[model samples]
Target: MAEFLANYLPAWLAYMVAGAIHVGLIINLVAVGALVFIWLERKISGRIQDRLGPTRVGGKFGWLQTLADGLKLLTKEDLVPGGADKMLFRIAPYVSFCASIAAFLAIPFAGGDYPFIVQHVNTGVFFVLAVLGLEVFGVILAGYASASKWSLFGAMREAAQVVSYEVPLGLCAVVPVMLAGSLDLVVIGDVQQGWFTNWLIFHDPATFLIFWVYFTCATASVNRAPFDLAEAESELVAGFHTEYSGLRWSFFFMAEYGSMFSVSLLASILFLGGWNGPLPITEWLGLTAANGDIAWYIGQVLGVINVIGKAVAGVCVMMWIRWTLPRLRIDQVMATCLKYCTPLAAAFFLGAVAWQWSLPGRTFFGLLESPAELQSVSEGWSDATAAATDEDEPEASEDQTVSSEPSRKVAAAKLTGAAALQIASTNLQGGK
Candidate 1:
């Protein structure tokens, strides 16, 4: 029976199994992480306001509060509003959820030659950003289809904010990409492999400054607090998904939490050195690509733990910020992005470039390797450069002993006379 099954399946089926494993892992991360975050939010918000939150439902921690809520949502009647565009309204939540899920495909949960990357896109950074941008489409469609004035207003504001913030977000994101020289997230992460100082956040003074800008932009791009004018409960009254209920409503929350985790993952990649922990435990223990054991599942397990630790820490910080700060007005949010974030990000980008040029090998205090120089050195010896240099020299540079005598230009009158003679010969032949 085993032989028969093996014969039926292609040898590459193991890779398919690996892909399925990754998908399962990501889905669990999103679903389980959402459940935990929701419960934590309730408890934290309650404590901040001096109130008990959900002590009755589960235990001292109210661990099962989200599960209970999910149960209730499942049992609730799925209501479609009379004025709603039924098809579009119903489809929007899944769209949002799917977009969030798709963003995970390019995210690497570890660093190594054989890391736990799902799709391994060459343009992984852009793919994540582009897929993330698509999440807003679902929000806009939800608002339009809901046929509610408040929902429409909220969705318009969200669309504008997301679209606007993406500029600074992209600008800030490019700083790390410029420092790393490749858009592949795995490559970017791998570049920051040594110490905590090697992280892009500490690459230079300019990159350090850009880190904060990137954080702010990432927060805004994810529609978190201060920039979350879209779903300001006191103002928009549930916002774009106002008309949504039951399982549909849960889907929007899933998308929101999923996006929160996505941006946290992004931050982890861009600034936190990805799977490279501050302690370097993995490397210290001799678990790297150089060692054959790195190809084993144990390495993957270590990477997953390392990456998730950073990502969860990021998300927790975001939650802390959310609970601590007041939501900013839409105008204030726009002003911050355009007036402050844009110029700061631009200046930092240039400064980092200059720093790389001036101090190519010299690390600040000798704590970290200059990622820029490493990128430059790697690029210098690339096949593309070799090809270009060969193309530039038909003959070797040392062999440039050709004559330097000036070549005479053809006289315009002589060329014209030759043309006329040729034309006359042609005419005579035609006449004959």
Candidate 2:
């Protein structure tokens, strides 16, 4: 669309318009997604406790309950403590909300020649983690600016918990990056493009274990119970946002739910095959990237549905866990991260590396073999290298090509990590 507009309008204007569209989409996603999750949480909690929740609003199902709550919040008077740092207090929620929403810029919703991504950063995984880590700073600011001891304690706990969990979270996420050989989320998702068994969670025993560890850390990272020691209602009043009111308070919830969805979507892309369903229904229906624009568009729409459905499912599971489990103490939260999750994640990372070293080119406990899979994985990089080499030595004779084989082999042999995995897989499959 931006490119289309560029044919008539200035290139700068076209780019700006495209960027605005992307920003609008993300903003709506975060805002509307938070509304739905809030209502869903209320309904789920009510059902678990054998009671009706919000039955009066928007008919029997209470569809307008969240909207009604939003209105009420909007109408409430904004308040700040007299002793509070008014400047920091005023800006904290927006900071948290912006950080939460900014992570989506690099997250791709679908995979194709033109993926449904905003920025398409090569280092998307790291970018998201780094941005998400910044959210805690807002919490700290909110707590300190509130001039409340309870809020300060909550913020400190949140900082400790989030920082601790991020170690294992990064380690666990690296497992899929190692498998896909790219930090680009679209590439990660595309690499797992076949059966559900191809998903990173099923890649090996270590990865299977790593998935659970990732979820645990993810839960903690998002401040969901039983890991939500930062906002224990029985202990602290309302945690970091205790002194906030009206839309300001609601902004905090929006940031929370937005972060929840972001991490859940990240999990989908990393481990659950992103836009790919458990079965190849879209492929069978002839809706694919290769089938022209209409088919590609339809495929992408379906991909969006697939990815969002998985993310919603993850959010619902978190809600269930929140309502069912008891909250952990701060000490227990730190212990869970340091003593268990970190060590387990590190072990699984090593185990996955070793497994890839030993079993390359095999899947499903080595019952299936496909050497071409590994070749396909490395083909993108290999082709780029070949193209660059060809461009640099266009005048080389056939004799030079023959002489280059040994150097090419040496280069291939020097491949390490994911590249090594691909080469080893190819060799093992060839030997078979």
| Candidate maximizing TM-score | 2
Off by over 4 Å in 1: 1-8, 11-19, 50-52, 289-291, 294-296, 365-368, 371-432
lDDT of 2 by residue, 198-267 (tens): 7777878898889889988899998999998777878889888899999999998999999999999999
Clash count list over all predictions: 0, 0
Task: Find the 10 residues in a row with the least total lDDT in model 1.
Answer: 400-409
lDDT of 2: 0.80
Enumerate residue pairs that collide in model 1. none
Local distance difference test scores for all models: 0.75, 0.80
What does the lDDT come to for candidate 1?
0.75
TM-score of 1: 0.82
